[model samples]
Target: MRYEAHLRARALERPQHAALVCAGQRISYAALADIAERFASALVAGAGFGNGERCVLFLDNRAETAAGLFGTLRAGGMFSVINPTTKADKLAYVLNNCEASVLVTQASLLPVARAAAAQAPSVRHVVVVDAAGELAGHEVPWDEFIAAPSILDPASRGIDIDLAMLVYTSGSTGEPKGVMMTHKNIEHAATSITTYLRMSPDDVVLSVLPLAFDYGLYQLLMCVKLGATLVLEKSFAFPQKILPLLESERITGFPLVPTMAALIVQLRNFRPEWAASVKFLTNTAAALPPAHIARLRELFPQARVYSMYGMTESKRCTWLPPEELDRRPDSVGIAIPFTEAWVAGEDGKPLPPGAVGELVVRGGHVMQGYWRNPEATDKALKPGRYPWEKVLHTGDLFRMDADGFLYFVGRKDDIIKSRGEKVSPKEVENVLYALPGVREAAVVGVPDPVLGRALKAILAVEDGASIAPRDVIAHCAARLEDFMVPRLIEFRDALPKTNTGKIRRAALQAEAEGRELPGEDA
Candidate 1:
């Protein structure tokens, strides 16, 4: 079923139930549904948005953003959420690539939105939210658009197989590519995930991850799907502010990424009461270091910590069950409920347990393909066991244990060969995290005539914690094999991160290559 239908159903069955709490606004199921329908009227009447057209939402975590999501589908059109921090050039590239019919954004972001929409000829309307009375001639105030009489005639709505949303993720080529997910694909994935999480209407979920990130967006969608209350926030940059919401909202489910968790673990004077109401904690975007996960358990003693692995191509691939967390902290766990995944060798056959190979996933959650890019799609979606099926070939390398638990090695291209021996950066980085002073770490291969490519350790140490190159090298040498240890090490105040807070490894690799290698030998 379409995501919009879930909101409508909740509105009809439990109109008075609280559906959303954001920015001092407590919106009920009935109110949220009305907002969605009215926004649909705005899209259809104001922009002439037609069936299957694209609407790009350049917004933050707000009530209108949620309304816009469901409204686009209600109008039988697909929607895309662009990261609010995206610059004009990149945003324009996405707008043109998707040929977006409407651009929905907030007043503060109007500068970049206005510039990008000006370049995208396909954008017919620029709908501005959170604006004052005055508006640019080309801009349509959100209040005016949604407040107008309901001019939308619900003659048609999207079916199960129609595209529901386009999630634009960073492409391997540095440009962005939109991952198209259908209503059926999303429904199945959402159902399977919520079943595994055991979420219900009584649950109150809180999230600060961006709407542009699929994981964050699902928190909003899944909560609505189950008739639950969602307490949405814009950022976790200041945990002091975010921490209070857990207790204030009586949050049951808390979803976070590794970076957020890192900050939480380091925060001083964390009150036991802050986590008293949290029933579970879900983590992805990257596996939490086993050491960090242990600390998180200490912090949220009552909360079940779930470590998961996924990509934009497929919503989620595997989740380490809370029951099995201590036993298998290193593994990303089995494939998420109902999905079948295996490690495939170069010959396109399943590899035996304990052998590393590319990960292959077969499920409804696998994205149909990249939008308008068949070349990349062909490389990712290949023949499945069934002739009619196209399974997603996740380019990441992994190994499954005898019990069918998967261990992420690294991305196919992320593996570094040094001293004529292959090295997984994740493995080295995991050990680095165990160090007392280290907060964040990324390992990359640097040019070396002797070792072929030397493993270099780049780290972000904790504040006021003194860490030296020798200290890092010595720690790794104690735990890692000779070739697996780094040959050089560097320290930075903070490692570069994506908008989602993932360490920008590719950016580091490129920067490392341009500069001359350091050391007397060089």
Candidate 2:
């Protein structure tokens, strides 16, 4: 089924049910549906947007963000949501790349959005939400654009196979690539994930992750499919303030990344009961250390912690069941429901257990390909078992245990070779996380005349804790082999992270090699 149909069904069934809660504002299902339909009519009838046209949303986590998403789908158009913090240049790149016809943003972000929109000549309309005054001839205020009353449901002109969303990845190596997903792909992913998570209409989810990230976007999709209430937050920058919303809203599910997990465990005055209402916690973007998992369980005694692994190419790959957390805390679990996952060697053949190789996935939810980039698409999608099918070749490295549990080794490009020996950064970072006072850690390979490449350990210490470079070296020396130990150690107030919260290893390597880094706001 198409995603917009889910909202329509929910609106008819439970018109007064709370569909979205953001910054003390509650929007009912009927209200959200009405607004989305109105905006969809405006896009087609007023703004002259054709079917399958692209609309880029550059707004924060507000109620209007949800409206814009469903409205685009309802209008039979594809949508791409950009990170609100993105600068003009990168924003222009995405706008031009997708050749978006409409740009939807808030009045507060007009300075950057307007600048980027000027460079993207294909943008025919700029709809400013919460605008204070009359807009330019080409731009229209959101309320004024959707003011006309029209049919709630337009004639169906597109099918499930049509493109639905474009999720742009953070470009650490070069320009960002937009991952293409269809309505069927989204439906399958949401169905499989919600099935495993056991979501229902009574579920209340709390999401602080950005909508630009696929992992964060699915939170809204899954909750809407189940007719659940979603509580949106701008960010986890201030955890103390978010803790209260978790309690008052009685949030049943909370999604997090490793960075947020580290911050939560380090909070000095944290109270266990602050998260007592949370029934389950889900994690992705990066694996959580076993220690953090233990600490989370201690804090939310009644909640179940699910450790998951996924990327932008596919919505998700694997998820470790909460019951097996103690047995294989390091593993990212098995393939998600209805999905097939396996490790393949360089020959493209499946590898035996305990052998490290690239992870391959086959499922309905795998992305179609990168938008307008066939070279990158060919590299990522390869021939499947059948002649008509292509499977996703995830660049992530993994190894399966005897019981078929998958452990993330590192990315294919993230491996470090020193003294003619290959080293997995994840392996070393896991040991660093075990050390006292080490809040966050990353391992990168630095060029060396003698060793070819030497390992470097970069870390961030816990709040109010002190650990010298020698102490970190000494700690690694005891836990790692001679070649695996870092030749250099550096401490930073914070590690460079992608917009989605993954460590920017390439940026760190560029800094070590004295190279200018690309714009990371994308």
Candidate 3:
């Protein structure tokens, strides 16, 4: 079940089916499979990058990015996909930390790629897509890469648990950390999702998520395994242009986050018929507030809406069923196929249902470890679980109900303390978002004289909508209790977000404390 195995299977089973669509270009399964193989050959023989080397892919959501990923795997080398928005300093840290030997990037990103490479002496070559330029010491034109004649080495028969990819995460502490994933780990995740989602060759998926994220990477693997059609959209900025394509192409499956979900429901003149062509609407990355969930149901009443939960440490842990929307609307649902999870107490002992504790998962989808950080690896993984012995201890806290449904609380670090009462920041943020005229809101704990930490709120209002800071605080007073309501409010045009699209509360707290000034946009 390696990546190429899925590619080969799809090529034989559904060669004529569209394997990738972007802009106006469409590629069949056979064509994609063939290009990946050629790209792999070029890496090994033409460029002398073989087994054990790591190649960093710095590109956006494009067909060539997918090609570079599978091609690296096919060449018996581990790969890491970088975020397109990563700047010089952070990008240099990841390259140097992983000791990447090669970099594969699109033409537009080559300048940044070369700058990052300059800081890491381990990098031997640069592979550029559609651009030719000498990068001081190393450069190769990616335009002629696949067309070049290069010998393909024998496929790796190594243990399936061998390293295949180094997926870097936004390090909350400082620098980003790379999470090592095996071929088996990737395959198991893809298989588990495809089975439960009931994906088939008939499913046509239009993906807007980036390939660097685990959630987005799984879409590619699932499509290959199920022999389904995949349309790789760059972004979800223009719903007007994208919605028609969804109907015209009859796209049946889509994975979106709450941000995109909010925008989709806001589309003018949106009809059920436009989205009726899609059979499944999946969500992840962050928890969808109950209010947003209700709105999604109203928009796509006929489509099955799946609320899933997972992290980079493990691909996906659980999924709430569309049928259980009414009964357990708040729960994240049972463990995904071949995965096992449980709540653990403060002492690290397992807890039974209804106990609020850390959620730990054990499965094939669990990553091997952080690329080179043994300390962080030891903290995250443990022994004695299912699928694999290595267990992934997710830092977020959750509680399970009698029927095995998981309800997410705030992150362990995100909890606020007021008069000895532990309050969830997410709870306050959710209420703030529900207020009229508010477009986005973030809650955080700030220094206080009487209490150890006081509740603080940051709000972003929609254009032309008016609301005073006191009015916003008063709105929270009506919904939340005296201690739970935020004592201070700050208004801004936008909230700071992580690369993966979660609100950056730490940054807001820093801004509140005057330790740092807000960004120009703010």
Q: TM-scores across all candidates?
A: 0.81, 0.81, 0.79
Worst 10 residues of 1 by lDDT: 513-522
Q: Judged by lDDT against the true structure, how good is candidate 2? A: 0.85
Question: What local distance difference test score does each model get?
Answer: 0.85, 0.85, 0.78
TM-score of 3: 0.79
Candidate 3 structure quality by residue, lDDT tens digits, 332-399: 88889998888888666778888899898878899988988998788888766344477788887999
lDDT of model 1, residue 134: 71
- Can you write out model 2's per-residue Cα lDDT over 1-522, one digit (the tens) per residue? 678889889999999999999879999999998998888998988888889999999999888788899999999999999878777777899999999999999999898889999999999999999998767778889988889975544556589999999998633233668899999999999999998888889999999987876777888888889899999998888999998788889899999877678788888888767788988999875567778899899888888899888877788899999999999988899999999999999866789999999999999989999999998889889998789999999887899998999998756665564543346677678779989898889888776533546789999999989888888888777655455688699988999899899888778877776777787733
Better of 2 and 3 by TM-score: 2
The sequence of per-residue lDDT tens digits that candidate 1 reaches over residues 18-37 is 89999999999999999899
Can you tell me which runs of candidate 3 are displaced by over 4 Å?
132-137, 385-388, 414-522
TM-score of 1: 0.81
Model 2: clashing residue pairs? none
